[model samples]
Target chain A: MRVALDILIWVLFAFVIIGAIPVAAGAYQFLLIPFHSFKNHYSKARPHLPRVAVLLPAWNEGAVIGNSIERLVKLSYPAGRLRIYVVDDASTDDTPDVVLGKAAKYPGMVFHLRRQKGGEGKAHTLNHGITHLLADDWMEALLIMDADVIYREDSLRRMTSHLGDPKVGAVTAYIAEGSADPNYLTRFIAFEYVAAQKASRRAQNVLGALACLAGGAQLHSRENLLAIGGRIDTSSLAEDTFTTFNTQLGGRKVVFEPHAVVLAEEPGSIGALWKQRLRWARGNVQLTQRFHKVWFRPSKVHRLGSISFGLFWFTTFLLPVAMILSSIGLIGLYFLERELASTVFRVSWFLSACTYVFLTLYTIFLDGPTGRRSWREALLFPGIISLLVMIMAFAPGSLDHWLPGLFGLQVTEVGQEIWTLSVYAWLSLSMVAAWLVKKVESTRIGRMLSPLLIYFVGYGALLCAITFDSYIKEFQGAAQVWDKTEKTGRVAA
Target chain B: MSGVHRPGVVRAERVTGVSALTGLDQAELSQGEATDRALTDEALWREIAHNRRAELRLVPEALLALLVVAGLIILREVYFR
Candidate 1:
């Protein structure tokens, strides 16, 4: 009975941690500088005649869906062969009209439809489209996308050809900046995305563990998708991620084609980005519960990577809270052995210095070849990477209304009001206290420390570690999920 | 992992072959649906067997066994090592 109980706990632990792979992946991609050049090999490559459709999911996105449709219909592939379908979820806006305009211009090239009554969300809308597709008789593969995602003419062709490999279940395309003008946050996200979509996901494909396809530009077989379920969960906000991993559950692969690039707008404001991240975080916490059993299957190498994904974040999420309290205790001990305090500070500074230098070199290399950042920008990469995560952790409402969605039906949890500001008032206050103490304490070590360390050590270091571990895991095909930090970008084009 | 259900059911045995394949990797092409049966005669099966004989090499499990041992050692250190 005791042995059985131990096994049960192990299984439970495995399930909880497996989905954590993606979160750690985001962090990993952020930290690691890649040595290899990332480019599209499939852009110019053709494949044996494979039927493909560009399936677009739109939700009240009248403003941008037209641009997306016009852009998609103009793709350079064989006009008669390639298909486009846009399914609009119940929209109060002129979204349907915009889709209809494009449908009229392209005639057979673009297919437009509205969601049926009782449709819950994007997932339901997609399900309706998948079932309602006229080309089901001819279409072999489906390219799932959002309303806002605009693909280059060659993007569709490159993504579809990769699906020819039986081991590859889905292909997620890379996101590049579409417009030249971008805010600092958007540029940061774009560069961050390139690092992830290329450096990390490619490495995962090398190992056969490519994680989830990006919702913006995912390509897969109609048969494989139908096998999972006809549609994503419209009831929830994170249909893309849910659908991606669920496909893996059916014994299919998820991949990234970095060269099949799509340009997307970044979220405009930090607050807007935060709300987007919350949706992702809630979805991830929810999915972690959904796919808990996948980890216990002994035959799958994915289970191992999945667990590492979770463990890394669980450490990060739990560690900062633990470390801050521990540091307080350590400081009290400093009275007894201030020498230990001296040593600890010195070690931290040395580690921080070494890590920053290593990261700067990688950024310089990436910047030199691709003009990813200006010289001054690349020079500030490490400081910004750490500073951003630290401030983000203390950002309002991050963990405010997570429990209800996170715990699902087992716990009756409630989400926060839209635009609920000041959610992190208390946590931020706590952070301020830690910072003040470290600042005022004229003790040997605290005096030498920078205010930046409080931000980095208390928050950024933990997130950086989490991102690194996940990026490596996902790059290697681990399906574990970390939340996407939704920038102020529209999903509909 | 299981019994073969039928010739083209569990794994679709490629019947028709594209005589001159395009950018599709040749190794993956055998799994594609070809309309012609005579194209996939015994010789092609033998070819697929040669190409698909092995999978990506995996690290030996012995290292994993040692990791488990090290985990045990670490646990012991925390308790009674």
Candidate 2:
């Protein structure tokens, strides 16, 4: 019995160390973001503007189609040079009529094509548009975009300018959340987008290999598109990611043009966000399967095969699982021995908090108003998620109740009580930190309290719980459904 | 916020040597130049930022801060008692 207990403790310790590896690496990467931003060099020059075809894929997008079409037609790019092709995927709504109306306004420039039998998917709609556009040899570049996304006037020009360099195969603009009436969820997403686009994408640009290009604003050169066989892939829910990899695989450089900004409406509710992110999570898993060779034998040819890109994707997929296991293991370890567990958990949590603080600061500094105004979203970053997971973790009827029986682990009554209390205590502390950060600001006491608040939130362990749930759903061969983020035509210009 | 013009026509002022790819294998042709430029630029920036440790300069600082803070937390939890 003694030997078994000792062995179990050692295994738990090993799990904690193994789990800390990815979290530490992620922290280091976050630390690298600010310096990368500082090194950003911009040069102003008149770029060669190529004849571009914009492929706007629509399906029941009546709410935003008119605005999107108008925005595209009024783009700063020359009317004769920039052609808008809206492929309406058999929408029962007035999307077709809206596109046709716009097409009439911009005669010969904006054209609308409707599929008789539609609703296959966005990827199919894009492919339908791509096929028709490829027939016209005059188009030097093609912009694959959605019907709901509104691009800034110079966005198309900035994206097209990258094509001036022949080495550039594709360029993607940053997609900012344009929710007119901001809710907590949308605000959090807005902050997340800043971190993702500003920090992560910039770091990727510096590395010369991007993890994935933004779906809304991808500009592909005609030649490179042809090299990849001229159709948007329909094999994965993440067709944009598929296309991004294909461009790199076809020996062309994909660039992230940050200056080109596009505003998109994101899901505003938790349920909606969950559905949307689940599709993305599942698509990533599918991407891993589809591009297994990229991992098995990484080479220069497949840029996705490169170390930075590959590790980033792999770690992102596995971190949640690792985190969940480690968290549970630590809780269990704490029940057996308090001092041993406290040191490990505190250290890991502290490192994660550092990463979180650095990311929030850099993301806020990079983007202006949205970052500053929505800064409170950072406090709730993982705090809310952590609270949810803690409730789930300790719920009487949930998975925790079955743990002892399922794992055949010996837990004294006192140990179990202590473990539950400790978890709740940690969660309460995190909530308090979040509350302080959200309520207190710019005061002397606020400044003093800020670091501890930042420390308490750490990498919201609840995010890991969410990811783990997604992982299980994907692993169970859950149906791959495109849960579209419902758009309300409420975007801030 | 710019003026619209004709398609496929490059204006005199806008036209530059880097306007478009001249070769059929434009993708491969431009790879060497872009890669070399990016690599050299990255190196220079790294050296200027912090010689030999530019990219990871913050790691040590963050790690140290984390350690010191975590040490205090652990001391409060365990050693203080």
- TM-score each candidate: 0.60, 0.75
Tally clashes: model 1: 29
TM-score of 2: 0.75
For this target, which candidate reaches the highest lDDT against the unseen true structure?
Answer: 2
Whole-model Cα lDDT of every candidate shown, in order = 0.50, 0.67
Q: Which regions of candidate 1 fall more than 4 Å away from where they truly are?
A: A1-49, A116-119, A234-236, A295-298, A301-337, A359-493, B1-81
Candidate 2 C-alpha error for residue A384, in Å: 5.6
Candidate 2, residues A208-265, lDDT tens digits: the string is 6777878889998888889989998897778888898888877788887676789999
Model 1 over residues A1-493: C-alpha lDDT tens digits? 9787556544433432332333344335433212112222232222423556778877667767788888876664445445788887766778788888888888877887777562365566677778876333556677778777678766775565556566556778877645446654454455456445554565555444445567777777766776776666654456777777677766777766655678887664433444454455455555555666654343363432454344433453343344343344334334434455334433332333333333334433332333345343333434443333222333222333343457662322223321121221222233444435344434556544533343333323323333333334434654433233332335333
Cα lDDT for residue A353, model 2?
A: 50
Candidate 2 residue-wise lDDT, B8-73, digit = tens: 344113223333322213332243443323223232233223322333443454455456545644
